[model samples]
Structures are given as C-alpha cells and as structure tokens.
Target chain A: MSILDLGKACTFSQMQLEITYKGEPAPAAKVWRRVKWQKEKVDEFKTDEEGRVELPEIMERSVMQLLPSEFVVSQAIVVTYMDEEYKIWVNSKRSPEKNSELDGSDIHLKCELTDERRLVSDYESDFLTSCEII
Target chain B: MTALDPLNAAELADDIYQVEDEFTREIFYEKYKDRFELGKDSGLSDTGIKGKTGGILLKYPHMMAVMIEGKKKTSFDGQAVFAVKGTAGLMDALTDLNAGIKNARTGGKVHQGFLDVFDSYAGKLPTLSSNIHTIHCVGHSLGGALATLTADWLKSTSGKEVKLYTFGSPRVGLEHYASKAQRSIGAGNIYRVYHKTDPVPMVPTWPFFHIPDGGEGDFLLPSGLHLKPWEFHSMKRYIKSSKGDGSQSLEWSTLRSRRPQDFLDSSVEAWLKSNSIVSFTLNSARLLSAAILWVVKKLTNLLGISVVIAGSTTFTLLDRLAMLMSKGLELAKDVSIWVTRLIKRMAQMLGIVVREGAEMTMRFIRQVFIQAHHAVSELVRQAGRTLH
Candidate 1:
C-alpha cells in the first residue's frame, strides 16, 4: 500500500480493492482518488495484473478542517479503461475514525465495471458506488 | 412573452460555475457564444477573500457572474441574463453563517450575508440598453439568494421587467420581505425550484421565509434516496430534473409538488406516539421543526407574550424558542406531554435515547436544540466545502 501525503491535514483509512471488467481482471487500469473538499489534489494509482489495487491512506493537511466545522470528507474514486472513465466510488465520510468508511469493518471491496452504481445510506456515511464490501 | 422558463435558467445557473476558473472561463464563453453576447465587462465583481477582514480589503472581481445579452432566436431575446455561482470557498461559507437579519433596500428585512454580497456585485453589472425588456436573475444555492435579492432590487429600481429563477436556495427574508417581493416581482414571474430533500432551502429557520409567499410558482422535485443535503442540493440534480428526457423539458403540469402545510396538533402528537423512527431525511427534520415552531407559537399566543427577540437579552432564537416550550410544559399537562414527545423524537433522530420518566427541564430541551443545531451546521458545512 502507498501513502500519499497530500498536504498537512488528516489522513484517511486505507482500503483494499479489486477491479474487474467484463468478468475479467482489469490490469493496469488507471485509478484516480480525490477528496472533493481539497481543491486540485488528486492522487492516481494503477491496478496490478491480478486486477488488484491497494488504495493507500490519503493524508491531507487542511487548516479548514482544524476549525470547529463538520468533518465531512467528500471522497471520490474513478477508474479509466480503454479511454473511458467509470465512477467506482463516491462517498461523503462523516467521521475521522479509522475504517469509518466501512463501518469499522475491514476495508476490502470488489468492484465490477459492469455493475450499476447504487446508493448505500448508513448512520455515519452516505455513498454511491458500483463496489461491494467483501 | 417573458413567461417563466425554468429549464433554460437552470442550465445557465449550472453553467456559471465553469467560469470561476481562468481556463474554464474561455470554454464557457465559447460554448455560449451562439446564444449570448459576452464581453470582458460582463463579469460581475464581488469582494473575494484576501485575508484578515474577510474580503473587506480585497475588493476585486471574481468570476461569480456572467452578464450576457440573448440573441434574437433565443427565448431570452431582448433580455439580459445574469447567472451567479454558488458557494465556492471557506469565505463564502462564512458569509452563509452570517444569518442575522438586516433592513433590505428592496423593502423588508433580509439576510445580512446575502445582501452584503449582492450589494458588492450589483454595481459592477454593465448598463443595459434601452432595447432590453427584462432581466433574468438566475443562480443555485447561495447564488439563489443573490438572485432573489437582485430580482427584488431590479424590480424596484430598473424600470425594466424583472424575472427571478433559483434552485435549492435558503430562505432570504422575513414575512414582510416575502410579501413585498411577491407583490413587486409578480408571483408568476419568480420560479423558485428546490428538491424535497435539499436541506439548504430549509435553513436559517423561522423568521426567514422564501419569496413568492407560501411557495407559490415554485417547483419542488422529488428526490431519490440521496437524502444527504449536498447530494440533493447539487445543480446537476436540478438540471436533470428540469430536463425530463434527453429531448423534452419536464412538464410543469405533471411535476406539481405537494405543498406541506403546517402540521396540525393532532398530526404532530400522532407521529410522535406512532414510535416511527425519525430518520435523517429533510422531511422528517422539517416536520419536527414545524411542530416545535407550532408549539412555540401556540404557547406565545396563549400567554399573550410577544415572540419578538429583545436585542438587550443574551438569548438566541433557539434559546428563546426552547424557553417558551419549557414554560408551556409547566402551565399545561398537554403541553408537558407534547414537549416530552417532541424531545424524544428529536433524540431518536440524533441517535440519542431519552430515559423514561426523566425530568424535561429547560436545560434538557436546550441541550437537545444544541445537538440538533450541531447536526444541521455539520451538514451545511459539508455542503459548503464542495469548493471546486
């Protein structure tokens, strides 16, 4: 797993993910991760031969977060394959706790390029995605 | 011929965001060249943040608005369109937090933050030719508040006909302002569109009210499971809802929204007693808030107490509101039961549990109000942080 020190802000919990296209491994697919709250800072990754990508913890140092404001980290993930971009994950993380995205469960997910994106509403977070927790 | 055209206005409101950046500004100008006549001076100026005083020093122009004249074939022919951008930075959100009421130049009291920004940029707009018949003010979110202010201002000053279009806007003024704006702008000339779940339109509570009084000539779209305020407040959602299919505009006839009238005392009590989970949806929040407002109004009316806030007292709107409810609890058993239910419902929504037979003191009600306000402020802050 890679750790991207985006800025001087907080770091997000790491997630393990697998990407598949048409029921086959999507090797070398470009993956982009961006925190919507942070302007102009997007980290890019690539899938391995086994269609697996280890999403490292994203650390952003934002003074804005230090204020007594909301801890809403708008997280987005998109994958590019064959000149087309597909959104795999879009979520607003409402907490600063580790693994809060997965409700304190392990951060392992399987995403299918062909799967339809769906909205999952929980107590602390709300996300729309084509990925599922494994 | 200047009938309300919400879809086209919504498109302008969504597209105005692109002009915020220098690179995208050119693209935005190019894309709309066929329909509008654009120039350098078309950019409206605002006191963008520099440092310290929160834009008091940096009185330069930002790409917040685009003043364009429509071509002959367009629906906005012989008219001007001023599209404003929504909240774009921390400073802008700071402006949203300045919810104090101020006397509006347009007639009644209005939101201080909205009026400050509108006044900052209104003078920068180019002089309209005599040929232009109407001015269409369009925006989303904060821009919606600006549009309302601008519409009211133009209607009062410009001699030209003024039309207002907004999406997911917060309440801009009090009752007097709402009624004044409704009369001046002609209720039919304003199109205030909002999603049922968008929390932005529900805030600054009480005293502050939406224009076109009682939601007349308003468009309320149905939201999907995206109950989160930010998702529902997105300009993309408004644009999509306005355009039904790829080709046809959404027919207003089939898109009539169910206006939520004030809940009766019985309805409020029934919902509280039904043991239904008070979820985080906007409707639930609104219903609970309305019920609380109803109780406060009823109590104040019964006691012949003036609901006005005395500037001398340190009590805030919520503080006074909760105090009234607590006072009501002491005078009548029915008030006690209703206040208890209301507190319980609020606790359930916030994932808190009120123990059975616990004393419902003024402090308890005040604490609940603080918790609820914190939750709402968090939602607003999150939505405000969608900067880029």
Candidate 2:
C-alpha cells in the first residue's frame, strides 16, 4: 500500500478471469493482480485446466478513494505463459464501488493471448487490454 | 563501455525522440551510424490512454525510446545505451498529470504514472548482449524518471554496471526509495544534472526525494537571472550547458558543490524576510524546500519524534506537515517566525494572496502545500503541451 497506509478507508471486490492461448485454455499460466493504490500486495494465482482463475474478493484499505481528488486505483492483471508475459487487463478504475469497472456488472472476462491490446473506455475510465467482458 | 559524456548523454536523450518519426529516424541513424548500431526494435513506441473528448478519438503518442549499441572506435564501445522520450502529445500531458504514489518493483514507492509508462514497455525492453559490460540509462523530464527506474532494474537483474544520467528529471520516489536507490546504485555512479531554473526537478516535492541523495555527485548548472521553466527544462538547453568533447569530468566540475545543502537556515530566513518576489530561480525554490525540510525535521525532533517517522511516505504527510508546523508555531518563537516566513515566501512564489496571521492556521498552510503541488503539476502539463 502506498497512499492507503496513511488512513483507514477500505474497498472490496472480486472478479473471474479466464485465460486462453489461441482457442485453447491456458492452464498453469501464472496470473498476477495488483491494485495500484494498494500496490504493496500482489495477488498471484495459477489457472486451472479450464483456464479459469477465481479472484477472491479483495478488500483493500486506503484513503485515496475518500479524498476529494481523482480516485484511480489502477487495476492490472498480467498473465505469464510459456515464459512470456501478456497484459490481460490494464484499467484505471475511477470509482471505488465493487464491479464499477464494468458499470456494476460482475467481473467476468475472457482474455485471449493472440488479441492485440485495444483501448476501451467507459464513463469511469479507460482500459488498454486484450480482454473482453463476458 | 564507459559512461557517456554529459553532453552526449543529453543529446542522446533528446535524439531518442527523433526516431519516433520515419524521416527523423533515417537522419538519426545516419548521424550515428559510424558510432553506433541500432536494431529494428531500437525505436520504441507506446500508447497512453486519453480521455474521451467530444465524439471523435485523437491519436495520442505517449512515449518513445531508443536502444543503441556502441561500435568500435566510439567512446561507448561495447556499451549499451537506452534512452526514453520526455513529455509529448495530449496523452503525455495526462501521464504527467498522473502523480499518485505507488509501490515500485525494486523496493520503495514511485510516481504511479512513471511506473505505468515504464511497465507498459518494461517487458519489451531489449536484452543486452553478453558482450555488453555496462548499461547507460539516459532521459529528460519524464524519460529521466523512467531512466532512473530502468537503471535500477538493469542493475538488479542484469548484474551489469549501470550508470544513469538525467536532465531536468523530477523526483521519482520518496525518501525511502531515494536512500535505497542511492545504496543500490552506488551514489557516485548516479549523475542527476539539472538547470538552476528548471521547474521539473522541483516537483512532487517534500516526501518525494531525488536519488543520489545529499547531492554527492549531482550537477547544478547555473542560469541567467530570469528564465522560464520550459526553456530551463529543454534538453537542448542542457546540451548547451555541457561540453561536447569526450572529457566527462570537466564540463560540470565547478557545479558539483552546488547542492541544496548550500543554503543554510540563516541565509534562507534572510532571503525570505527580504520579501524578494524573484523566487522562481531554482536556488530560491530549493532554499525554501530546504528550509521547509529543515523546519519539519526540527519540529519533529522537538516533539520527540524521529525524522524517519516524519519523513515517512504516507498520504497524510501533508496534513501532518501542517499540523507539525502549527505546533511549531506554538512551541518555539524561532520556529514560529520560520514557519511564517516560509508560508509567506511560498505564497509569493505560488502567487496566492495570504494576509498576515492567516499562516497561523494549519488549514491555510496545508492549502498552500496543495496549491504548490498543483502548480508544479500544471507546469508539467504545460511542458507536455508545448513539447508536442
């Protein structure tokens, strides 16, 4: 945690992310997630044979969202497969609400390795990623 | 495999941006073909997220970098040099505006925007050949911040000698990061060169500290009495200050001694009380910065708190700073005058109207800090706009 260390504000959320190489599931790929505001903690997981990784709801405590300033907890989900890393998710989440990344919808995404990174924008923020909302 | 001379390093930092355009790329390669070898991936490009404006999307070129290998008969023989571009385009302006603190992979916290830009291409950084014995990282402005991170990474992973040369680079990290980087990179090997009037280096102030801390090997180039931040921050202006010849040591020999430590409390107080409105000069700004740091240190020591605690990179540090200054106002008379003088000088520099005794309020002084930071961010944004 960086700015969060100074105060006691907390936010919690969880998401389901799927990894694929070409058309097949990407099993055993290491998925890394970090909340930009709470950067000290990095959540790591290994995808199952189905290429599905369940991110347990993360409850990060920080004062950044409480401030009357720009609230951006840059969310990054990168996957390492076959010694190469790919950015599956890169977003600057502007609101602290759960699932606000997808306008209050559940965090379900299908990411493809072959897909080129594209810029996607919502009212909250802009995301540069290869993942599509499922 | 030696370090690049100051002028050469500045030029490389400036020229790295040229490769972003095809025509300039040809000219760049032609100019250095005899002294260096560039690969296809040498010209680096990356995108930045831009805010949606109206109904149309605009092309936002975020960052550019160049990786050059020194050929035989050149001073950088067997050496690898990586230089990144500074602020340019609308997206870069947004990047400069993203000034939140985040955890750095190497050790401490760094600017979130700088880390994001670096991370976008960190995986793509070309690997140096085994023949390369040393890595020289160079950049100006935002590129300088990225270069600092690159030097730290190369030193940690590549196990090669790393030398960093930055011009008009902003403070990349906090005190913990600065000390850690200094110890990791070896203080003497880091060269943080800046013009006396450049506003870029003065930003992300206080808690955020520049590396090679205590200015053991830093170079402070003096400038004319009046100069704009953009002019002082330009890489061309830096090249003008440094010598082009192969000699690396003599170009900034006389400036090694001109660090922030040169301004003592007495001098700072005298200058502040003099009511000199001409405070945009880098020295005056640095003096005020030094004075503030000094006052905070003294205030903490007086309150039985260690400097380490007060210097922590916490979000409430600004609030704590104002509170401490308020307490300093009540506890010691000298501290009171120092605080008042500091607020006055800071207000003058920022062009904020503050009447007498208004500095007595913690909220008022805290607002000053916030305004100061906002001013710096605006300056960086302006730089980004004009650089494009």
Task: Give the best candidate by DockQ.
Answer: 1
Worst 10 residues of 1 chain B by lDDT: B44-53
The worst-scoring run of ten residues by lDDT in candidate 2 chain B lies at B47-56
Cα error of candidate 2 at position B374, Å:
4.2
Pairs with steric clashes in candidate 1: A7-A61, A8-A61, A9-A60, A9-A61, A9-A62
Taking chain A by itself, what TM-score does each prediction score? 0.85, 0.83
Q: What is the interface RMSD of candidate 1, in Å?
A: 10.2
TM-score of model 1 vs. true structure: 0.64
The best candidate by lDDT is 1
Task: For residues B271-331, write the lDDT of model 1, one tens digit per residue.
Answer: 7777777666546766776666666556666765544354534665567657767877888
| Regions of model 2 farther than 4 Å from truth | A1-134, B40-63, B72-74, B89-98, B225-230, B244-262, B272-286, B299-317, B323-337, B344-359, B374-388
